[model samples]
Target: MIKKALKTAFPYSIPILTGFLFLGISYGIYMRALGFSAAYPIFMSMLIFAGSMEFVTASMLLGGFNPIGAALLTLMVNARHIFYGITMVSKYKNVGKKKWYLIFGMCDESFSINCSVEVPEGVDKGWFYFWVTLLNQSYWVLGATCGALLGSLVTFDSKGLEFVMTALFVVIFLDNWLKEKNYFSSLLGLGISLVCLVVFGAEKFLVPAMCMIFIVLSLARPHPEKEVA
Candidate 1:
């Protein structure tokens, strides 16, 4: 079991390192610029626990975005986590006490790990899930800490730095798409979101797009039989 777990973890080690390092560093930079200290990132990652939200919070902090607005927006952005939990509830039943952690750690990358790996029979499913989650969250926290430090050094060219978060989303979207599940709905989401973006502009479009997607996708009942998709 240990050997197989190690073998499985091997393939993900590179991506897990690379993605988290750069992205975490970038977020750290932004957080520092927003007047957040080292403790901020640690607490945020530990408690707040949203990768994209952590980045957006930097902007929100700078802009004086209140808790209510932040919470609502966060719900909109990470609404997907709910779906991830719903799908995993059954697979995670045998997880026992670890089920809480499973729900808590259901971030984008964590979900990818949970959904992607096929556990060996008789191996501990809970431990596999826990380790994958722990590793990814470690990357995120490390990245954010590194990013905060790097932000102190590089002060310019942050204009396009925001795109890092978007790129991360694109990668996730592609990963989900390549699995041949939700590819169509994702395309529709892109189309509708783009149209909404052009129509309402960036700030105003997000809520509306989220609303539309929720209503449309829910009404469509996309691939109801296939839980993972």
Candidate 2:
């Protein structure tokens, strides 16, 4: 069952594998440049799993200790997962013992694929989701470990590596947009985000944008009674 599920899950994960490896390696190198040990990235990749937040965390760690501030920042940066969890509750509810890890390992890539891709007939959905999450995390861990170990030995310009995460997200968004028929949500999000960016500036726009998007999407969803009528 695991083997079969792994086979089914791997192809969906290939794009993520490529992106995570490059970004994860870049993260490790960044940590090393910050005077951190390889163990830092390895553990952070395993524990945090949120790419953007992990990068933010590197800077947080460099600064003075402030648990309350770090906690608030982490929540703000990862607030989107609240929406992801809501969307996934039904799909993941029946996954039995694997549900815990599924929730823990639900990174952006895993969520994108699992939320969108339909599982094939005869494949165990639980195992399929599990394999996808595990594989993605493994790629991140492997890349971070490699980068941290090799960071000291390598010598070259490391500028612009931070943009890898943004690039990966753009690819994911475009892929989903192409597959989707209804452009309302995409356009709405983009429009709201742009408005928020202009109004609030990049430093303060995220939370307000997320709140508005959630409210708009919730109100926009069609009612079952209306559909029945």
Question: What is the TM-score of each predicted model, taking all chains together?
Answer: 0.71, 0.88
lDDT string, candidate 1, 39-116, tens digits: 787678767677777777767877874889988988877776776776687888877787888788788777876775
lDDT of 2 by residue, 22-72 (tens): 788888999999999889999999999999899999999999999999999
Q: Which portions of model 1 show Cα errors greater than 4 Å?
A: 1-7, 63-65, 120-122, 150-229
Each model's lDDT comes to: 0.73, 0.89
**Backbone N/Cα/C clashes per model:** 5, 0
RMSD of each: 4.7, 2.6
Candidate 1: clashing pairs of residues: 24-143, 25-147, 28-147, 28-148, 29-147
TM-score of 1: 0.71
